[model samples]
Each structure stands twice: as C-alpha cells, then as structure tokens.
Target: MQLSVTLIIIIVTTLVSISGFSSQKIIDDLIFYPPAVTQQRQWWRFFTCGLIHADFGHLILNMYALYIFGVEVERAFVSIFGKYGNLVYLLMYVSALIVCLLPTYRKHKNNYYYRSLGASGAVSAVVFCFILLFPLRKLGLVFFPVMIPGFIFGTLYLIVSTILERRSSDRINHSAHIWGAIYGIVFLIVAANFFSTYPVLQSFVEDVKGWLASF
Candidate 1:
C-alpha cells in the first residue's frame, strides 16, 4: 500500500522533532530564526522549521491534529482535483509553513532573540481546510461534554487566538495559527478555481445553508 502524503509528513516531522529534542544543533539549524534568515539568508528555515518542534508535546499535538484532519482533506482534494490532488495537497502543506510565518518573519527579521520551531501553522491550515469543507461536522473538546459544529469551533478558535496574539503574553505564536487558517481556506478556493472546475465556494455555501435550514 502506498503511504499518503499526510502520513509521510507525520513520519518525517516526528523523526526530526525527536532528534531535535536531544540535539541543540539540530534545533538551531532547522528552527525559524528570523535573524538567521535576515543575516545569513537561510530562508529555507521557513519550511524546515516545521520539521523540528519545541518539544514532544508540541510535536505530538501538531502531528495528531494533522493526521485527524489531513487524511480527509487529502481525499477531498483528490475528489476535487483528480490525479493532481496529492501534489496540490503537498504544496499547500509546505507553502503554508512559509505563508503562515511571513508576518512573524517581517516583525522579527532583525530580532536575534526570536526563534520558533513547530508544525502548528501547517496543521492549523489542514484543520481549517477540513472545517471549510465540512462546516457542519461535529467537533468536540477533550474535557468538554458538549460537541459543536466545525464552523463554530473554528470561529471560537480564531477569536481566542486573536486575543492571545494581541496580548503577546506567551511564546505561543498565535499569529501563525490565524494566518495559516486563512491561507488554508483561500488556497482551497483558489486551487479549486484554477485547477478544477469545481464550484468549491458555492458548494460550501450550499452545504452551510442546508445545515442551517435543518435547524
């Protein structure tokens, strides 16, 4: 059996992230250091940084989220784009790692102290894309008893991420999450329009409308 792009990403990211846990050099080289890119022109860090993570928890959470949603998203892409689905999916994931971090790069390009390493941005892109494709799908929290639709969860996520990003109280890069999600939605819409004749936005709207009508 052939390995899906999602599984391949998980494997590669997991191995590199685990290696970085013990090797500072590995993290130093792969991590997104704005100064490094600004000074040394190591722009590859934008995409390579996703291969390494801050820690085990960070790696696991991102990979798990990607696995949970990426497979479905891949299938959806295949359905929409035919033979080129896997390629498109791969491009989206890699490009998201860069696009999601562009704002951070601009803000910290000269700040030597700023460094980030994780796949949260790309994972958020995949999760948000899934939510866009299935807005009415039920989403549940770990400790919460109530389950809400995907769109509601996405909205709440964006709101909380925005507030936290504005506060700048923690090291978490919430800005990346916000941009990645928006990029995911836009990527799908544009890809569909350019590569296929599918009316993706129209279909999403119809799905949402049908779900609302049922209430």
Candidate 2:
C-alpha cells in the first residue's frame, strides 16, 4: 500500500510539472478533447489529457481521493491476484480511459473541440473497486458529512453522473468517472468469479478471505 501510494503521488506530481512547463495554449489542446476541425490535429491528446490538470487544487483533490481509495483496492487486488495485481490495476485504468473516450471521440469526430482533464477516471477505478470489495461498508461525503452505505454511494454517483452529462455547460467529466466506476465494478466481479474456480487462484482467494475474516 505504501509503495503503491508513493508511486501514484510521484507520477501525478511529475505529470503536473510537465503540464506547467508545456506552453499554456498546449495545455488546452491536450485537455481530453480534440481541437476543432479547423485547428491542427493531434491524436495522442486523448491519452495525454488525463495526465494534466486545470489547477493545483484539481490535482490535489483528485490525488487525495486516489490515495485514499487506491491503497485498499491494490491490497484487495494483490490478495486476489498475487503478483499480477499491478497489471490488473493498470489494465483497468487504461481500459476505463479508452472506454470513456471512445463515445466522445466518435461523437465529436468532426468538431474535435470538446475537452476534459484530471485523474477522475483513475480515481473512479479505485472508488468503485472499494465499492465492490466492501459494498456494505459505510462512507461519508466530505461536503454533506452524511454516512451512507458504499453500494448506495456508488449507485448514486452513477445516477448523478448520468444526469450531469446532459447539462450543457457543466465542466465536470462526470461521464468518464461514471463509466470508469462501471468498468472497475464489472472487471472485479468477473475476475473474482473466474479466478475463484481455479486451483492456485482459489487458494489465494481463500487465504484472502481468511485474512479478512480474522479482521
């Protein structure tokens, strides 16, 4: 957990510094949306945009959430998948990004001017993984300070994202966050069931279950 958290912090800080050093205008182009049909085209921006942030506050808030949620998820992954845990996490992160971007890319193929940024997609992966691993656990919102079941929080987040996506001027990339959560929940459920039936995987899972039971 400590190692994973440290690596994430280092990666986020490095990306933030790179964004600051890049031309100010370049930051706008790299933000999760392609440029207008009239502007110069850059296909790699889809992946690079996620590495930049709108501000220090934005980066810190996202990183904080990632740190809080990602550590537990990594532990769960390692308990279930052993040495392959990091690979699974990486795949989930990349898959969520691609899945979230595909629809936007397809819809704005001509205009290519829509834009987004931040670590919301990766954060969503961690959040939803927590929801999956500990669905019955309680969580409290920072703003509301109201305690709620993890499953309820996860469901409400998805609903809110869907509603927010319809609004025209909303700056938040709620859709990506929602889809990323879905990807994490589905991936873990499927992987857990598939691995539970295998000899080695089942042994690891049983050991994890025993460890959890002891707690």
Candidate 3:
C-alpha cells in the first residue's frame, strides 16, 4: 500500500502536537500569537501554529476530520488538475492556514493574550473542498445524530461558525472555520475555471438536482 499525503500530514501533525504537549516552548513558539507576529515579525506562526493542538481531543477531532476528507480531496484534485494537482492541493492547505486567520490577526494583532493553535482551519478547507466535489454525499456530525446532505451540512456549518465568530464567547477560532471553507470553495471554482475544463458549477447544480429528485 502506498502512503498518502493525507496520512503523512496526520503523522507529522500528531507527532508535533504530542511533543508540544510536554514542551511549552514548542507551543509558545509555534502558536499563533498575533503580537509576536506584529512586533517581532515572526510570520512563521501563521503556518506553524497548525502543527500543535490545544489538547488530545482537539488533535483527534481535527486529524480525524482531516484524514476522512483530505484523502478524497487530494484524489479529486489529481483527477481534475492532473500534474499540477498536488501543487494546488498543497497551496490550498498552506494558504488556508494563513488566509483563515487574517481576520483574527487584524482584530487581535496587538492583543498579547490572544493565541490559537490547531489544524482546524486547514482541515475545514479540506473538508469544504471535498464537499464541493461531493455535494450530494451524506454527512453527520458526532454530536448531531442526523445525517444530512453535504452541501446542506456545509451551509449550516458556515452559519453556525459565523454566529460563534460574532459572539466571541469562547477560545475557538470560528473565523478560521468560516474563512477556510470560503477559501476552499473559491479555490475550486477559480482553479477549475482557469486551469481545467471541468464543468464544476454546472456539475454541482446537476448533483444537487439529482439529490433532490431522489426524495
């Protein structure tokens, strides 16, 4: 069996996150600390922050989600973009890490107490990309007992993320979730239009219609 890029990412992230559990320095240096980025110019945190997670639960949830969706998204990209697919996949993930946090950075760039660490942003990007290709697929959250269509799930997710982002009542980076998903859909549309002959939007409509007709 061949090792996939998705598996490779999961292994590396799990190792780094576990190591960070013992080494506070690792977390501090790698965590997305806006003040550090703004004052000391430590820009790497934008990407490195995704390597460490807050706890075992956080790590597991993000990694599991990433693995489930990322593998399919990677495969789909290869089919769509051919030789440049891997590069595009990498670009989307890496860019999502930074782009998803831009809102947080702007709002808290001077706040010394603000810090976030995890792969949730990048994972959201992968999941949404998968959703775009498989809009009619069934999906269900662990806590949410009912299975729903992928596109419907994505829509509800964005709405919830937006609400949580505005509330700002918890430590979770809801903004990252919202923006990462947007980036994923936008990336797919732009990439397909410019680099491939795939009828992404048309296909999406047909898939939705097919799903609707089934009911």
Candidate 4:
C-alpha cells in the first residue's frame, strides 16, 4: 500500500510538472498566502497549494520523504484503524496544511503579499508521524550526517524549527514544519486514547516517557 501510494504521488507530481503547472505558481495563485489576495479569491487554492512544488528538486525531495516515511506511517495507521486508515491519512494531510497556514496568516494578514510554496507541512506530518510510530528507530540527519533515535530526533526537530522560526529569514517554512510536528504528536496521542488497539502509538508514548525519564 505504501509503495502504491508513493508511486501515485510521483506519477501525479510528474504529470503535473510536465503539464506546465508549476507548483510554486499554483501556491502563489491559490493557497492562503497574504500576497495572493485579489479581488477574485479562489478558495480551492488552500488544498491545491500542497500538491504543488517549486521545482523538480523540491518535488523529488518531498516525494522521497513521503515515500520513505509515509509508507511506514500508513502501515501503522492501517494496523490500528483498519478500514479508517485512509481517512486518517487524509485528515492528517489536510490538518497539516491548515496548521501551516494559520501562523503565516497571523503574521502577514496586513501585508497581503506573503507567499509560500511546497509540501513541507504535509511532509513534516509524515516524518513526525513516523517518529511517533517508531520512537526507537534511528534517524539520519542530513546536515550533521549522524543517526539519532526517533524520539530525540523528533524533539530536536521541533526545537530547531521553533528556534529557527524566531531567528531565520530563509525561504523554508520552519514554522509550518514545527506546527505540523506538533499536530502529528497531538493527533497520535488523541487517536491512541480513543483507539486502544493502536499498540504502536501507545508504545511510542511510553517510549517517549521513558526517554524523558532517562534525562
């Protein structure tokens, strides 16, 4: 199922790119960016923005992460939710976008020219979900080139994104990533509470507690 979904994402992205539909342009034209406001507002842009990527490199990177982490998260979700797994995935993706847009909207409501593109928020959702589902797994950092356990990595990621949100002016949506991670963590906890069969998430919470205690 994971492989199938990954292939579908790649195919859809590639087809969209080949059709001359730039993801960045889509984001610029639609999504809830402050700068995108015009006399004629297109509300559908909010959902379409995530499907668009700035370039091939951007698309490839995001798709790769989606394929890598998304599959595992999907499997775990299916194991727990059974028939409701797809619904959870859909909700997580949409929730990430909503959370991502709010902070930008709050900060730039008056500017009406703020723009952002890419699927970083949704990608963060998958990455963080993976971390929660597999807290003991080691994650390799691209910058540091080292592997760290999932819980530590997830915590560090949240912290780094939060810190960068305050200090950086880079194009990357660090705030969206941080917020998406928070959403992922919260979603998992809430879902676990409601669905006791999701041992993976339950164990993850326990592992996180144990990791915290070790400090």
TM-score to native of every candidate shown: 0.97, 0.78, 0.96, 0.83
- Tell me which of candidates 2 and 4 scores higher on lDDT: 4
* Candidates 1 and 4 compared by TM-score, better number: 1
List per-prediction Cα lDDT, in the order shown: 0.93, 0.69, 0.92, 0.72
Candidate number with greatest lDDT: 1
Q: Which has the better TM-score: candidate 1, or candidate 3?
A: 1
lDDT of 1: 0.93
lDDT of 4 at 130: 86
**Model 1, residue pairs in steric clash:** none
Alpha carbon lDDT at 202, candidate 3: 83
- Count of backbone collisions within predicted model 2: 2
Give me the runs in candidate 4 sitting further than 4 Å from their true place: 1-3, 17-28, 35-41, 199-201, 209-215
Which run of 10 residues does model 2 get worst, by summed lDDT? 196-205
Candidate 1 ranges with C-alpha deviation above 4 Å: none
Clashes within 3 Å, all models in order: 0, 2, 0, 4
**Per-residue lDDT of 45-135 in model 3, one digit per residue for the tens?**
9999999999999999999999899999999998999988878898999899899999889999999988999999989999999889999
Error of 3 at 107 (Å): 0.7
lDDT of 2 at 72: 81
Looking at model 4, the pairs that clash are 34-112, 35-112, 35-113, 35-114
TM-score of 3: 0.96
Ranking of all candidate structures by their lDDT, best first: 1, 3, 4, 2
